[model samples]
Target: MDERIKEFFSWSDLFDYMVTRQLSHIRGNWELTWDHAAQEYEAEEDSYAELINRLVIELSELDPPLKYHDNEDRLAEYCKANLNWNIHKIGARWVGSDYASILEQGGFRDVNAGDLCLAACGRVKAALDRNQLHFDDMEEFHRKMLADVVAIILYHRSDQCITKLS
Candidate 1:
């Protein structure tokens, strides 16, 4: 709807707005818990971990294609590793952590995984387009490019997405 929001929906924009928004919602919850626990020292110190764990689970439930064992592991590792730590640094690093590497590695040659991921990305792009989330030709193309990339990734992994192309 908004231009800034449109910019974020671009695949070439370097961040997935939907995912970012979801993460932000999680962060807001985490902050609320942190504040609550800070005021109540006797509060369970494990509350943050529990919240993160739940968020990770929730994120994994978004789309079957996006859901993976590695997704849970990566999110858990990030929550555990960065608890009570620097928010900015953790936020920046969490995105590029083993979660993606794991997805890339496992999705390779795995038709189910690749197809799922590509489909999930496609759904996201389509939703964005329907919501008027494009800034220009470049942005529109960017979403398509992401879809293409996912398809290529699927092809590279298992020749499923590009059976005819290859």
Candidate 2:
């Protein structure tokens, strides 16, 4: 295993690298939506999605030598970073809480939960692409789990749990 590849094997390390390199760009370019009641701004529709897409594309296009030498650490890092961004930033921003609370509501978790969950699905899809993990090859149970998670996020968003705060 190449030394570089050995370094990226830990998803946490990759996530840190990605955050250091990319978070500034994401924060700078993202459009802010106004929340009248909160008198604050948040990411606008599809902004998060676009950011994720760009990151995935850029990461995917990197020279294989830089991305990884042998192990799939690059792909795993991509997955974990995407998930962390959605769950920690986008989700928390929208939901005002975490998945546990949202789940206890007896319906959708909340707006944030929905946002994060949807983003998670997108990240998962990107991971599949990066790692060449085939959806077709996944067990039915795994597929269903992914679908359920995505559905919960969509449901939360659809339920209007994410209010304009006005």
Candidate 3:
């Protein structure tokens, strides 16, 4: 019912799927892993962008529109600038959910399937070492990356929800 909850649940298969990617990579099938993520993005185009755009508008208009709010414009620009390049391009491979953090780290490196698989190895190791099976990093990655992807993949499907943004 809640928008954030809906977003959270939208990627219910993320963790396990990441794990699956890890195993496949171990088996020397890294391309398969990247392909899965790429397909997911192909399925994404413009849908999630519309969702976030609406959210920014809704939140900004809570009280007759906030004074210092141009979230809509900013989001639009974000979509235009970031999403313009399709992930399906030659060097635009899926670099796992962790690549999402590279922005905050000021490390603008391109993450590929190998990087994702290696990160998977680390997460898997952490789980085996009794760390909390956390997806915080991945979740943050989803927020930034998916929004960017959707924004780039423009479409007019404005009134639909992948699940329900209610």
Question: Whose TM-score is greatest here?
Answer: 1
Off by over 4 Å in 1: 1-89, 92-102, 108-111, 114-119, 122-130, 133-153, 160-166
Per-prediction TM-score, please? 0.27, 0.26, 0.20
Model 3: residue 111 alpha-carbon error in angstroms? 6.1
Query: Per-residue lDDT of 47-122 in model 1, one digit per residue for the tens?
Result: 2223222322332344433333333244334444544322222542444434344334434434444343434444
Q: Rank the candidates by TM-score, best first.
A: 1, 2, 3
lDDT of each: 0.35, 0.34, 0.29
Name the lDDT of candidate 3: 0.29
* Model 1: per-residue Cα lDDT at residue 92: 28
Model 2 clash tally, residue pairs: 3
Q: Give the per-residue lDDT of model 3 (tens digit) for 1-166.
A: 2233223323333432442233332222212111234222112232242333343233223322231113222333333356552222124332322333322121122122222222323332333244333333344543334333222211222223452323
| TM-score of predicted structure 3 | 0.20
- For each candidate in turn, give its C-alpha RMSD to the true structure in angstroms: 20.3, 17.4, 19.6
lDDT comparison, 1 vs 3, better candidate: 1
Q: List, residue by residue over 68-159, the lDDT tens digit for candidate 2.
A: 21122222233335434232335223233443233324232233542333334443444455552533333455443333443344334443
**Model 3 weakest 10-residue run by lDDT:** 104-113
Off by over 4 Å in 3: 1-111, 131-166
Top model number, lDDT: 1
